[model samples]
Target chain A: MYPTDCRYTREHEWVRIEDDTCVLGITDFAQNQLGEVVFVETPEVGHVFDAGDEIGTIESVKAVAEVYTPVAGEIVEVNENLKDDPQSVNEDPHGDGWLVKIKYSSSSAFAELMDAAAYEEYTKEGK
Target chain B: MVDFAGWEMPVQYAGVIDEHRAVRSAAGLFDVSHMGQIRVAGAGAQDFVQRLTPNDVAKLAPGRIHLSAFLTPEGTYIDDLLVCKTSPEELLLVVNASNAANDFAWAAAQPHPGLAVEDVSERWALIAIQGPKAAAIVAKLTATDLGTIRNYGFATGQVAGKPAILSRTGYTGEDGFELFVEPADAGAVWDALLDAGAPMGLVPAGLGARDTLRLEAAMPLYGQEIDRETTPWEAGLDWVIKLDKGDFIGRDALVASRARPLTRKLIGYEVVGRGIARHGHKFVSGGREVGVVTSGTFSPTFEKALGMGYVETALAVPGTALEIDVRGRAIPARVVPLPFYKRPR
Candidate 1:
């Protein structure tokens, strides 16, 4: 089950808006599909990005997948803990595994993103 | 799960790191049924097998196993396999799944009078139980004396009430057994092994962990480390080739080429920097491409990046520094000795 407080992207990333700031991380399904999280390349804070921009990478023992930004914003903070213990993403993908936090202009812009029920079905289709 | 050589196999069950740790610390069971088995038996079986592989086949007495390679006529690898001499008149060849059909065809094509080569893959299934606790976990299941089966020794017996050929061999660089049983009994044996090993902390591992575990043990993979284009000398597998084995395929060329200086050499390495070097990554020396990585991964045991690569022989020394081009960025690494993680023996 996915958290209903956040909106999900087709890429399997989850984003939750609190006031003008949004916290971003990959969904549990994405982490499960990747097998094991070995390395996460953290993006530089204060970097401006548009939606769908290739921010960084997450690597398992056998694969390398690109992490894409779900919305346009300037990065505010990143989970520095990932550099030392990337397996935390597999251990706690939703809570302590949050990848980045970004300051955006409006929370209303994320209304178009898929809700939990829709994202759950999307993952079932294996898209 | 993904399609691997016509078989749908799980890349990882729980996870690669978890499975890898399971094998290292306690125990892990791997369904290696995808591997193919070919039987060679007849009056001339011993001589036929001796000519087919580079290892000293005659030295492999009954109930013994040895690693060997089926080479192209040009001294490159056709496939790497394990040769088990079940008896004086019988031998079994275990080969990679993707190369099974081709290897079977190649072996059958060779002229060896009085010998019969049969593909017995479908009739048998293999399960590898590996780690330090693997022996005890398996010892609880069968009546056979596992203690007497030295490394590479085997015996035919009943495992979980099913007929099996239990061999003391494994790919995880641990002390363990590879159980060869009938396909009809595979499901039951797998279930029984897991249930028996559960109390001892045994988990079912997958191919992802298999690759990483073998890499840490400094084992050569087929397509990556040694292929049709790479010779035994270049891959650092000259030990497996016995020149005195007498008139084997590729022996002439391999012997003649022994005096030639090696252009590139395979060496193990540790990623001292911040990146995991996966397969096919370029090995750079002085900003120029000189070699390539055969296998690379984030080691669960060492908790650092490790890989095997073929670089210029001059740069293959233990302390030589090199760069692996990871995603267009150069990450520094050093050529360490082989077997990055060894068991605490």
Candidate 2:
């Protein structure tokens, strides 16, 4: 089950809100589909991105996928550990593999996204 | 299953790492039926093959096999294949699955009046049982002497109550057998081998693992390592090209090439940096592009990242430091010796 505590995007990323800054990572479903994560290129600290901007890329042996930001914000912190240990994304994409922490300008950025329940059905129905 | 050259094939069954280790540790079975086969026969069969390939095909005895390739008039690779000699009058050429039609068209276009060229691809099914325990498992089903079949050797015998041609050849750097059976008997042969090999830790592997295993063995993939734009000498596969053999298709071009020094050469490398260098990744030295990776992967055996690529001939030596642009970042790498993994003999 997807965590009911976070919001979701159509591109398979999750936003876990913690105070004014929210943590971002790919969903469990996304990591499973991508297979083994051999490399991760994360955004640097203080780099600002708008909603739906591709901030990073995750590479497997056979494929590579871009990770887009869910909300408009400045990247306050990036996961530095994933550079050498990218398999953490495959093992625990929701927890240890959390990609970035964004400090958004306003709460309106998360308004149009799908809720946790809606996102679960979206993945289950192959959307 | 993925679409590979009009053939539906699995890239992985269990997983790449799991299937890869299975072959390295015990044994793994592969359904290589998609690989194409062309048979040539007649009194001129030997002479025809000699002219078609740069290798000295006349040196091969009956019931033996040798690695060789077909080249363009420019001395560039058309495809790499295995030459299997059934007799002096008849022989088979097993080529890459994707290159089958092109290879057939190339050979069929040649004017050899006495030699018969036929595409027998649809009639044959090829299976490879590879690893340390492969022989033990295969020996349980076949009547042929698995012990006496020297490397690059083969024999016709009954395996699992069916007629089969078993050869001592493999892409993995391990002792193994490649079984050539009819399409009708492929299922039975596969099932029987699975049942018989289960005890010896044999598992069904796929192309994903095959790519890694072959790369670790330093075997070149035709499309990437030796393409139409690259010659055998540039890819460091000059050993297979017999230049002294008279009047092959690429003879004149290769002879002229031998006099000049190579501008670029293929070398093995390992990434000491963060990212795994992939195919087409740029190799840079002092911020200038030096070469490009042909085949790269995270080697399961060594638990490190390695690959083969063409670079400036001066930078092809082992211990030369370079950078590979994987994604947008330039990751550090170093030229290393070929065959990143070698099984204990």
Candidate 3:
């Protein structure tokens, strides 16, 4: 099940607004598909990127997937604990597994993301 | 589930990591029915098989098995296979499913009067039970004394009341058995084994774990480690080739290649830096590409990224430093002795 406060993308990334910044991580569905995550490559805290830019990479035992940003923003913070405990992404993708926090350019980009209800249905349809 | 060759198979049942550990610690069952079985029989069977393989076929007496390869006249590998000697006049060849048809066609085309080579793959299914507790679990179901079936040996008997060929040979490094049964009887035998092995922590494993287990054991996969371009000398499998065993398909060519110095040699390595060095990743030293990874995985038993690759013989020494080009970033690695994990004997 998806968290109600978070917005979702078809790429299986999730974002939740936290005051002035947003916390981003992959969704639970994405973790299940990736199997056991062995490594998570996170970007630097001050890196800037446009919307849809590749943020980092999540390497599982079987395959690798790129983490993409849904909204253009400057990275504010990155979770360094993931370097030692990559399994957290598969164990708790929505909370402790958050990859980075970003200061966004506009509030309109958040609205474009699907809410919990739409995301659950969207995942059911699949690409 | 995914399609492997033409058969639909599970990549995992519980999970790859969990299943891999199960095989290492307790027990694991694998439905490997996709492997092909070819039978060679009749008057000239022994002589025909001896002339076809490099390994000493004379040593493969009744109920014995030995790993051998079908070689091209150039001394290159056609495919690696198991020669299961059922009797002096009959032998069962277990081959990779991907090369089953081609291997059959090649073997059948050879001119050998009074010899019968038939592809019995369609009628057979293979199931493997592996780990420390595999024998005890299998012992409960059958009357055939498990002790009599030595390693690399097989015996035909009833399993779960169905006729089957139980061989004490497996792809995983752990001690195990591979059961060859009629397709119709496979389901019952599989269920019986799982049910019997359940209390001992045996679970159904898949192709994903099978690969990791074999890699940890340093077993060479056909296409990845050995191919037409690779000779047995380069693959670290020259021990299987017996030139003194008399004339065979690739004997002369093997003798010629053995005399030449090896250009590349297979080596095992552990990733010193983060990131798994996957298949086809290039190994670089001082900005020059020196090798290519054949197989790699995050081993559950060791909990580190380990891989196998072929490097220039000069750089194949253990403790030599190299870098694996994973994506665009270079990850530091070091050469080590083969078989990242071995069972405590």
Best by DockQ: 1
How well does candidate 2 score on lDDT at residue A79? 92
Per-model B-chain TM-score: 0.99, 0.99, 0.99
lDDT of 2 at B89: 87
Give residue B339's error in model 1 in angstroms.
0.8
Q: lDDT per residue, candidate 3, B225-268, as tens digits?
A: 99888899999998899998899998888899899999999999
Clashing pairs in 3: none
Looking at model 1 chain B, which ten-residue stretch has the lowest summed lDDT? B250-259
**lDDT per residue as tens, model 1, B201-316:** 99999999899899989988899999999999999898899998798988888987797999999999888789899889999988899799889998989989998989998998
* Per-model TM-score versus the true fold: 0.95, 0.95, 0.97
Clashes by residue pair, model 1: none
* Candidate 2 runs further than 4 Å off: A79-85, A120-127
The local distance difference test score of each candidate is 0.90, 0.90, 0.92
**Number of the top lDDT candidate:** 3
In model 1, the Cα lDDT at residue A121 comes to: 97
Q: What is the TM-score of chain A alone in each candidate?
A: 0.95, 0.96, 0.97
Please give the C-alpha DockQ score of model 2.
0.53
lDDT by residue for model 3 over A16-126, one digit each (tens)? 998878999999999998899988999998999898999999988778899999988899999998999999999999989999999988768888899999999998887
Per-residue alpha-carbon lDDT of model 2 for A1-127, expressed as tens digits? 8888889999999998999999999999998887777778888899999888999988776667899987899999999889778889988988999899999877787887889899999999986
Better of 2 and 3 by TM-score: 3
